[model samples]
Target: MTAEQRPPVRGYAKPVVVPERLDSLTGPTTGIVVLPRHLKWSGNSRYDLDQPGRIADLYRTVLNEAATSDDLSRYLDRATLLDLWSSMWLPVALRGKWEDRFPELRHRRYDPAA
Candidate 1:
């Protein structure tokens, strides 16, 4: 099949941001992420509904919790970032396998970090 006819392919990676600004942020920051237009169902629950993945949510939660705890050191580690990703994606993968088969999705790459 031609590229246009194929299903969409999307990707998302955690942003590498400095620890300074993650604190002192007042609200949910606007950011980009990849997600399928259709959500997959696993058992009785559903995966993300065309929204940010759990990884992004976890990143935000970590920032919020860290700010309160005054523990900026934790967010600096890439392994911690990856752990957040793993925690987020495992459910998606399982849902995809059983329900949607991990259909290719849409993606856009933002370079704010650059």
Candidate 2:
């Protein structure tokens, strides 16, 4: 095909879709969550929230693989997210995307005397 006739290549990266409000996060408070194949096709996908650090692990997984708004709304909660935000280990892309959408999520140190 000629250069002019060639179709432009589109990016495969999906854009992050954050809800309008943090309150929109209404996921389970406490329970065992089994991720679907789409979100977690490999490794163990069951997360027992009752266990130590399991909730954070679950949140990390969901935030990384969630393909739709419903995924986020169904697996993450505002209170839980906020509690783990500072300590949660997240990918740079996910962190940037989420922080960009919600500036309040960016953790900053409180300067006592600057």
Candidate 3:
């Protein structure tokens, strides 16, 4: 599946504040309780949920940086970043020649078409 079609990574729980003691063997005194793996919130960023192709482009760009061992910040020229992000999402805007063709995918809900 294309990166756009692939499911985003999401396997973590919401943090919950609580009181306990870890050193005392009781656990946190008042911090948070992370839930088990099966029950958790999707870890996707708001941007990713709202814009998958942008997120995909970010992932691709980061991978490129790691491949070259280059500092990502150095390459963050305003135009370059915007170009990559904008190009990556161009497909979403051009999908199906309009909205009616893919009614099911138009709503939010993290769909790539959205």
Candidate 4:
């Protein structure tokens, strides 16, 4: 498939930063995770993982704002990210970079119209 032209990805200084491996994402699957200052600069920082909507929101925010793969590793779980990828609201650039690096993400469908 051809790539779509869009704005450059932000939050990281380097271009297209993806993890060397996904299994390293061994973060909490439940409970509240209060985001760090660098990750959550504004709004509410605490995310209740038990709540589906809140967790999805948290994943979306973290995925978009993370400065590096380590930031993602610190907050996101591999299973949770795989389960939530299709539903989370994400920027085109952020989503594209991830989907490119991880083909499994491409299989999960996201409908912005929803």
Candidates' TM-scores?
0.20, 0.78, 0.21, 0.80
Assess the local accuracy of residue 86 in candidate 4 as a C-alpha lDDT between 0 and 100: 83
Per-residue alpha-carbon lDDT of model 1 for 10-51, expressed as tens digits?
442322223343233332223333322221112322223236
Q: lDDT per residue, candidate 4, 48-97, as tens digits?
A: 98886888888877777788889889898899889988877777666787
Highest-scoring model, lDDT: 4
* Candidate 2 ranges beyond 4 A from true positions: 1-14, 108-114
* CA deviation > 4 Å runs, candidate 1: 1-52, 67-109, 112-114
Q: Name the lDDT value of residue 65 in candidate 1.
A: 31
Question: Model 3, 37-80: lDDT tens per residue?
Answer: 23223343223313435434443333232222122332223333
Q: Comparing candidate 2 with candidate 3, which one achieves the higher lDDT?
A: 2
Per-model C-alpha RMSD: 16.2, 8.6, 18.8, 3.6
Cα deviation in Å at residue 73, candidate 4?
A: 0.7
Worst 10 residues of 1 by lDDT: 101-110
Clashing pairs in 4: none
Which prediction has the highest TM-score against the true structure?
4
Q: lDDT, candidate 4, residue 90?
A: 73
Candidate 4, lDDT over the whole model = 0.79
Winner on TM-score (1 vs 4): 4
